[model samples]
Target: MKQVNVFLCLTVTFQMKWLINHGKNSWGIHSMSKNLDIMVKHLTRVEGHGNIVVNMKDGVLEKAQLDIVEAPRYFEAMLKGRSFHEAAIITSRICGICSLGHQMTSLKATEDALGLEISTQTELLRKLLIHGATIQSNILHIYFLVAPDLLGAPSVFPLIPTHKDVILRALRMKRMANDIGDIVSGRAVHPITPVPGGFTQIPSVGELKEIRRQLVEDGIPDMMETVKTLASVAHMIPNFTRETEYISLKHPDEYALYDGDIFSSDTGPAPDSDYLKMTNEFVVTHSTSKHCKHSRSSYMVGALARWNNNYKQLCENALKAADSLGLKPNCNNPYMNTIAQAVEVQHCIENAISIIDTLLDRGLKDEKPNQEPTRYGKGVGSNEVPRGILYHEYEYDRKGNIIAANCIIPTGQNLGNIDDDMKKLVPEIVDRPKEEITLHLEMLVRAYDPCISCSVHFLDVTFVE
Candidate 1:
């Protein structure tokens, strides 16, 4: 049709213009000074505030850091002396975006410490809740935070005039995901039902069936549309790759988000008990948050890492979406993280639906977790949250009270990797306009979806040469 052709031509023109403008030294930054010192305070469109500082002299890079400027909160210390019953409730305050994840991990750790086993129905509901949170988060990042950069818009608010339909589709998908969490966990944010051992409330069959119907009808179509949109702007993503160790939870049966052993791209697999060693967290002078490394100078986590580790476990629909987006496993490109997230949106939908059907076929039960503490000891719980792998460990006293606690957040694990990424990415784009270079660096950090507020907990910073 003539209208279709006109739209296609206009899109091509826009893409071409954007590429040309961004690829050149339009701002005369390269010529203005032989040395560059750029500081970005309080980055935008992400969950929390952080800074990116880069200093380059005469084309030689120097001093690149992703600074965690947020104030430190002693979350682990807060856990000490708290009752086992309140573990999940208090930990859920870590981040508004990842509240469910914190609650789930905290509960698992507490349950393990108390030597409790959950029911099949409870497990299924937890998985559904995880899927819902993943869907909610990935959709928010892909649509609201990441899309504007690819489409050359200032922000999602500016897109309302021209891209109203796409915005509505995204909002609808996010709402469905939030409702899924609400139905399972009693609230989308800071869920109240999923406590240690098991949930206090469970969804009825009628409610679950309606949720399933909506997922099948509304969720699937919107996801397909989202993939198409990403594919259109895929070219805008920089073709930069820096191979590094990828870490996440892995299982033979399925993509392990809910539970599994620790898996790293460099070092195959380790038991969940070895999480403390696996993290190898250390402090840096440039950051208040701790940085992580394992078998390399830096490593990466989150969706891209999970995809690389468990691509075989992805559902057929999700696999198709990945293939269509040209996203293959063993991908080293961090920019493709947004694409991987889009793929996961499809994967989570399929898995959630299957879980709902299984729950319905088996029937629901109003079971309470009647777990009694037999002994007191240490226990660790790790799961694949949206940002990446999250670990919570607790040492409980004989009286079912916490003595000590430690939580290794995903963004803390990722800080080192982001800094390393900046060191490599800056040189590649240093010849361009300084603003363009800054935008690229910011995009790289945003691709990780770093929750700086969630990460800056407690780290004894030590300055060294």
Candidate 2:
């Protein structure tokens, strides 16, 4: 067994390739179709640590599981007893990739607890920020992480040589998205301006106009090229499909990524307060993270879910991108998640422009955020984050201090669905070569874009006699 690791300075990316040769009769065994115990100590290309284990004995499947070994982050414990004003700042540390999502959701829950209201300008700015983060995250996942698999390469580093232009295009789009976040929230990665009720500092009309210009000139053109790039490799994606429930926030006027009612394909729309009933999380022994279910054994969330529930609400350009890419509503293939994300990137870019136009027309306001808390109570804030529907629930005391905090991340909710998918996928490909089986499984998980770091929070281990 040999391993090679490559680091690309251009993209700040690292990828690993394994070279294993189990020579015939090396271990007194000659048949490749014998009993097997395949254990992947660590998976690659994802945000954090996880393992995939599949077992089979003489052609009979035994076990297939995604084992998450990351330690619990205990972010909820850190929130307890903290002031309402600091919730967003503290929760932002949960994930660097989705820091803006955490901050916005935290602020919404905190503001609701104190009965605070924000201005129209603030809401418009927040919507732009969400779009920016969505674009940034989706581009990173599709090009840097998943594209290599489709191109039959071990990592994106190899693609850089053959597909240099595609790599550059991806970087350009990512930079523009990050700039949008920086302009609105004061920084891209863990935003600084947005607070409980509003932004501490808002962009000027001039800045808004400039961003709109960029979105119109550069963002849209690049998205068209991106759609073409992905469509060229659409055939590389597996055609497997499994009908399951899709959940996301849905709004009547527009595709909901910022705020809306919880809508499930299995059921209809429900209030955000009923998130607990929607996300019925339970423990699984193979993983440290909890798996969630709603209206079935498992359900999916994220860009694909959003598309399934709110496809009609997408902007004209986004709808066109979907049609061109052959990505449609109720797309049951998990592998199409990457395609959905790409479609969303285009949608978010157009929506950001519309939001900026609205802000410019309304004119910038210098009003400070609402800091006064009329009363303390329980509040739940739900938003369609990059990964999926994220819920932040808080119970505040009279003095505006947190009594309890519960955050249900999108990745945590998708673990069960991934497990179920794996159980079905392994059987279909069990007769093939081991390397092929492993690659397919990896592709399936990457399609979900699982953030192991964000998935592992507090967990209670129980024993049964």
Please provide TM-scores, in order, for all candidate models, with all chains considered together.
0.89, 0.88
Worst 10 residues of 2 by lDDT: 2-11
lDDT of 2 by residue, 414-446 (tens): 767876777667656666667676777777877
| Model 1 agreement with the true structure over 114-210: per-residue lDDT tens digits | 8888898888999999999999999988888888888888778989989999999999999999999899898999998898778788988889998
Candidate 1 Cα deviation (angstroms), residue 272: 1.1
User: Where does candidate 1 have its weakest 10-residue lDDT segment?
Assistant: 9-18
User: What's model 2's overall lDDT?
Assistant: 0.77
For model 2, how big is the CA root-mean-square deviation? 8.8
Computed on alpha carbons, the lDDT of every model, listed in order, comes to 0.78, 0.77
RMSD to native for every prediction? 10.7, 8.8
- Candidate 2 total steric clashes: 0
How many clashes in each structure? 0, 0
